[model samples]
Target: MFYWLLKYVVLGPVLKCLFRPDVTGLEHVPATGPVILACNHLSFSDSIFTPLIVKRKVTFVAKAEYFTGKGIKGWLMRQFFVGTGTIPVDRSGGKAARAALDTQLRVLLAGSIAGIYPEGTRSPDGRLYRGKTGVARLALESGAPVVPVALLNTDEIQPTGKLIPKIKRVRLRFGAPLDFCRYSGSVGDRFVERAVTDEIMYELMTLTGREYVDVYAASLKTSVEAPRPAAGAFEPLEDRAR
Candidate 1:
């Protein structure tokens, strides 16, 4: 009830007037039944704009922190996310992965759209990173078609660490639903999981035309701290002690 109220009655009208988002391939999304909208995670705003444009409610597995923040602002944020079909789940470890999958299955079984970001986290760069196998697992388990969604230019509107979004036109492109019926009953198989995830990422690369990076986006933080050059290694050392 709150989801519909916020979407149609309150916030929806305001967002539509501001972004004027250009959406393509709306017909690709199934008008009824369970469907998994697998989208690229770009910005915090991606969570907002994607659901706003889609006709159906998209249940995204949001980080647990958003729901557990402190004080009034936190309370408001929690309400906003909850109203938009955002489910809270800890993404810190493998067990949390299973929990998230279970949550998505329940949503799909109930005949609702499950929105997932296979990349697990937002891209540090614009390049598309390798997706996690959790989405593939959800699709195979629920027998829902994976619809690849490319949310274009959302990062530009509200980038990382910025509170307010700039006024800009954004676009959303939905590709045809991918059926993994051939891979049925292959759940928990590492090889099959990787294949399914790669295939989805491949289609996303083609649809979005962004550079493909085979590593996880979370590793970017580690890369920053990776073994720095020892004190100006590039500089000439005392002219080789001539």
Candidate 2:
């Protein structure tokens, strides 16, 4: 298939030879099992190099537009995402957000590793943002072990909005797997999900050592002239609910 071909034939060999990405704690990855590889999002290339360095296929929950785009560039992107085993997700959130979790569950139940960014989207600024409960919901619902992964120096290789990335050595660090079996049957409990999500964010923050911002990344993109919440008051995490 295109996935294996690209990995072993085309891009894989080139990436491995060029950057020779460094990885630590790789032994933490289970030899075989359904697990969640929760990673910090730094650059768009984080998606590419994250899986390239791992032994198992890491299915990322990418935006649907990558698969639905048009024209020659669209065709190439669609093929790349598909060949890389990336799942298209609607970032609209709410019911759509739950749907994305369901899709990830399907991948988990099949015993494949699902790669997810707890931040929900790439950080416009590099600081870490609060994680969404969907990751907690997925973890509890499927009972998969969560491995915190840190991808370093990828932003330098391919920064935001750049089409081509220069060759640069990168680091991929995998952390201890976290088990939330105590909260397994407690799905839909807002308190429990928030507790679990915060725990996951703490792990990511610890691994990456990035400053933690208590808000979603998208909210920071709003126009300065847009209606703003009162000082010291921000949208509740449950309002956006993804």
Candidate 3:
């Protein structure tokens, strides 16, 4: 398969030699069954570097734009994503978000590890931002254990808007699996959902040791002309509904 060929024959060996990533706590990942790997989004390379280190075939939900672009470059990008098992998800909210979550749920139900950036988008400032509750929703809905994965120094390799990655050392730390069994059957409640999401974010915070902001990453990057809500006031009722 293209995935193995790239990982073993092409990109994998080369990347390992170049970056010399320090991977820790990989044993925490379940060797089998469905698992959710919730990580902070620091850079575009987060997706690339994660699979290189994790032993399992981890799949992340990537933006649909990556697959829809035109031209030869776009064609290659789409091929690479598909080969790597990246699912295309529309990042737009409302029905699009629902559809994306449905795709993620399917991946989980298939008993494979699913990677998600709870922040919903890459962190423009490298600081950990408030996480969206979609991750919790997925875990609760799928009955999967969520593992908090902290990736250090990926931003240094390929920061926002950088086409090429600088050779740099990176560290990947995977925390123990977080159980949400207590919230089982209550996933529909907004309060319980937000509470569970907050708990997962707190664990991620402890693992990453990054400065936490109460705002979502996407909201912070919105254009100045866009109407802005009061800080922390944008928390949706569905977040608490479960």
Q: Which candidate gets the maximum lDDT versus the true structure?
A: 1
Question: What total of clashing residue pairs does each candidate reach?
Answer: 0, 0, 7
- Candidate 2 residues lying further than 4 Å off, grouped into runs, are 223-242
Worst 10 residues of 2 by lDDT: 227-236
lDDT agreement with native, every candidate: 0.85, 0.83, 0.83
Q: Using TM-score as the measure, name the better of candidate 1 and candidate 2.
A: 1
User: lDDT tens string, model 3, 157-206?
Assistant: 77777888998777788999999988889877888888878888888777
Estimate the overall C-alpha local distance difference test score of candidate 1: 0.85
Where is model 3 more than 4 Å wrong at Cα?
223-242
Best by TM-score: 1
**Residue 101 CA error for candidate 3 (Å)?**
1.3
| C-alpha positional error of residue 219 in candidate 2 after TM-score superposition, expressed in Å | 1.2
How close is every model to the real structure, measured as TM-score? 0.91, 0.89, 0.89
Model 1: what TM-score? 0.91
Q: Where does candidate 1 have its weakest 10-residue lDDT segment?
A: 227-236
